[model samples]
Target: MSAETRVVLRRAAASDAAAAADVWLRSFAAALPTVVRPRSDDEVRDHIRDVVVPLRETWVAEVADRGGMGGIVGLMVLDGDLLSQLYLAPEWRGRGIGDRFVALAKRRSPRGLTLWTFQVNKPAHRFYERHGFVAVEFTDGSANEEREPDVRYVWQP
Candidate 1:
């Protein structure tokens, strides 16, 4: 699935907050073997305030080479060495966009990279494995445990 696809990876600005949230909810909800709350118009705005706004850096992935105005296919939040909330639109999956975003996150966090995924998201677990992340821990107490347990993975290189 790797075609040397060119995607614009750049620091997300305050102006792009809404679009980024849109893509996040869309992709988050569409991922397989997991359940995400369906974000309403209000919820989307609330997420931007509660989640995205707090990240150290929110990076946006766009197909446009110059990073011009367009849809955000994927995004990643860098919290020190931890790469939290990496998501890509379902339509963009398998296109290597998520892989590129992961690479960007790792580069941004050279100390290491860690993230969590629903234990049931086998495809995402495999994707992380392919990127050198190994599961280090698991938790069955997440509020969403009714859907699936959660596993934490880390890559230290």
Candidate 2:
């Protein structure tokens, strides 16, 4: 997993919905095993297909090798000034895919960006912080669907 390996980041299509949802599921389970998911696998895929991909600025990251876009290694969703979601396949975690995605997010939303992450997701907190995001708010497990304590981070640049 060299940082130099090329990654093709492009808008997700309807066909990518299931794969993107798969990345989300794997990343969620790997990053926050204790957190309970409110939706089933099928429901998640359906939501990604119906709502996230079509209605939001969703991007899928794929490895580009031999002139073809390979399997999807990560996915991100951007909603206006909010970086609604950014998830990477478990094995792709520390290989710069997330950094590139965050860079793209910042480029897309130059004004600023805000995102929420579970409080227990320390790796995510550190990753966002390294990308210039600062913790601006924290909330108990009441506001989010996960019912897990969360922290809000904002990047102003």
Candidate 3:
């Protein structure tokens, strides 16, 4: 799909867990090649469905295809003021969906929002920076599941 394609962002439903999990896995694989992902695909899928979807305030972005069917292309998860996850399909990156997701998070949490990204994910750093997030802390990879160095970014309105 083109950058101009209309993307509908809404609260994620239980039925959307699978598609959102797919986006999450694909985005992680494409964006964080250097980080070690320890979870098997099935494990990640189950976590998304059982843990993330049920516990987090999640949103999904859906795009209408030419065939008139809508497909989930991206998703964001917020836990309190923490932007825990934001992922878009590989074909949907650089199309302002990420920006929209960040905007939604900011709107929902007017006080502030914070997130962590692997230090090796330079593209994510740039994306977050462009959206007004500033790096507040850096870690030596001990705190996260992947055991990769990470940077924490915060945005305050």
The top-ranked prediction according to TM-score is 3
lDDT by residue for model 2 (30-106), tens: 88999999999899989999999999999999887764547888999999999999999998888888888999999
Q: For model 1, how does the per-residue alpha-carbon lDDT over 1-157 read when each residue is reduced to its tens digit?
A: 2333456778877777777787777776677534645457577767775667555677888765443535677777877777867878778888877888888888787878888888778888999999999999988835552445788999998
Off by over 4 Å in 2: 2-5, 67-69
- Candidate 2: the clashing residue pairs are none
lDDT of 3 by residue, 37-150 (tens): 899999999998998888899999999756677789999999999999999999999888999999999999999999999899999999999999999999998988898999
Q: Name the candidate, 1 or 2, with the larger lDDT value.
A: 2
Q: What's the residue-level lDDT of 124 in candidate 3?
A: 94
The candidate, 1 or 3, that scores higher on lDDT is 3
Give residue 17's lDDT in candidate 2 (0 to 100): 89
Instruction: Write down the worst ten-residue block by lDDT for model 3.
Output: 1-10
Give the TM-score comparing model 3 with the true structure, all chains together.
0.95
lDDT of 3: 0.92
Instruction: Note the residue pairs that clash in candidate 3.
Output: none
lDDT of 2 at 107: 97
